[model samples]
Target: MELKTRMDGQVAVITGGAQGIGASTGRIMAELGATVVLADVNEDGANATAEAINADGGTAVGVRYDAFDKDAVRGLITDVAGRFGHLDILHNNVGGSWPDRDLQVLDIDDDTWLKIFDWNMHTTHWATTAVLPIMLEQGKGSIVNTITGGAQVGMSIQVAYGSAKGAVSSYTRYVAVQYGRRGIRCNAVNPGLILTPHAVEVMSEDFKRSLFDQITTVRAGVPDDIGYAVAFLASDAAGYINGEAITVAGGGPRSSHDAEALRVGAYGPSVPAPPADLILPDLH
Candidate 1:
């Protein structure tokens, strides 16, 4: 059966929509008939994305500002509500740090930790807080956030990034539980090593290859994958799936280095595994 995803006359605001997964989501939502507002710090890139949507005969506009700014978020919510009279969806896709800067727990500094928290966790916190009032007024809405496997499994050089993203996942559930009764749904999309423009600029070919090779599917992810998931969660199609953290990874390596023995004994001996206390499991 064919599924129809018509979002005609709806209004959406997407943070970090200038490029990467956020930009792709904006384009997809606009094409599906929503009035997309591309919010980002990069004016040129934001305008370019809006222009592309316009050229495609979709409704879109650019709102340039730092998503981390509380004032900016408040103004954004007010503007979108005043213009469209209601907000149906909000996608929070900002916040990422370089691997070098994103260090392990002991190696990271206070400033770095705070910066990551503000950018990743606080972006979700403030944006969602500011938008909830408008959504409550309308009595229905969806908010999608970006997270990653690292947030749950814990990565070597992503202490700050992982910790902040974990907060996003936790907060997503909190929002859903708090507002589901009020007709709002909140969820998250955790993208793996997607080859976004920002990622390509920072990651070496060898490093990128190693990432893909590590995946069980032997393939890296792309922005469109994340975009598709965002669109689904934003649409009424996902009305029943609130407080979910949907991974966009191609079912990443089921075994970490310490769990390699489990692969060898698939149907044989029961291999010793890491204690459940060590690593967080995927939310069932």
Candidate 2:
């Protein structure tokens, strides 16, 4: 018996595909033989990404997407299905947190909270609803949502953003349970400290260092780390996976290091070193 991960003959639409993780996912899916559509609010960026994919011998197209506009969302999905004849994958990757505005809970205003929800949760709901009909008709489809670690863990800031993403996480399960019988699978990917261009520009050195101190992996995650995960979820390879959120954060925090120290204070005193004569097996 053989296992397959290739997405041959599939048509994939990736929202927010202008750059960062969405663009990377588009490139990866295209490489796996899917005809990828890079849909984004940044039309030029999407076109540039699509052109690059095409130049690399993959099938891809760029289109404008306005996640906040319900009609636009529906129109995008309808247009893609009509043009490609079938839409096999829908990656809802349009989301962001306005760090400046997304302060602690009380500091965040009503408008900011609503905006965060619209960006993170509403967009996902709209896209999923728009694509479900086409997917139901085909009797098979995959939907992957981009969530965030902030939603799963306790965070000091970005309360609204994290809360909105938490809603998305729940929505992922709802879609999977409701449509799994119809051959529709929905899941989410939670990214942690990925060094995308926007992240690099916005994340301060202090913040980066704080995150690095807690991260288990030696280096920060790149867009490809998440792109590959999304590709796998969108492919036949992850057909059995549904309603789950996978963290692509380079293994998250180390159990006994920075995070634990922060949680429980420093070792009572300088902890005594192991006995000098103690022998340890070379597991390596």
Best by lDDT: 2
Q: Candidate 2: how many backbone clashes?
A: 0
What does the lDDT read for residue 79 in candidate 2? 95
Summarize candidate 1's per-residue lDDT along 130-236 as a digit string, tens digits.
89998898889999999988887777788988989999999999999999999999999988767776666777755654553345453467788799999999898
| Per-model root-mean-square deviation over C-alphas | 6.9, 6.7
**Which regions of candidate 2 fall more than 4 Å away from where they truly are?**
1-3, 253-284
Tell me the lDDT of candidate 2: 0.86
Pairs of colliding residues, candidate 1: none
Cα lDDT tens digits for candidate 2, 183-269:
999999999878787776777756666665456455677788899999988888898999998999866744436565643447444
lDDT score, candidate 1, position 128: 89
Model 1, total clashes: 0
Residue-pair clashes per prediction, in order, are: 0, 0
Report how far off residue 220 is in candidate 1 (Å): 2.0
TM-score, candidate 2, is 0.89
Candidate 2 has its poorest 10 consecutive residues by lDDT at: 275-284
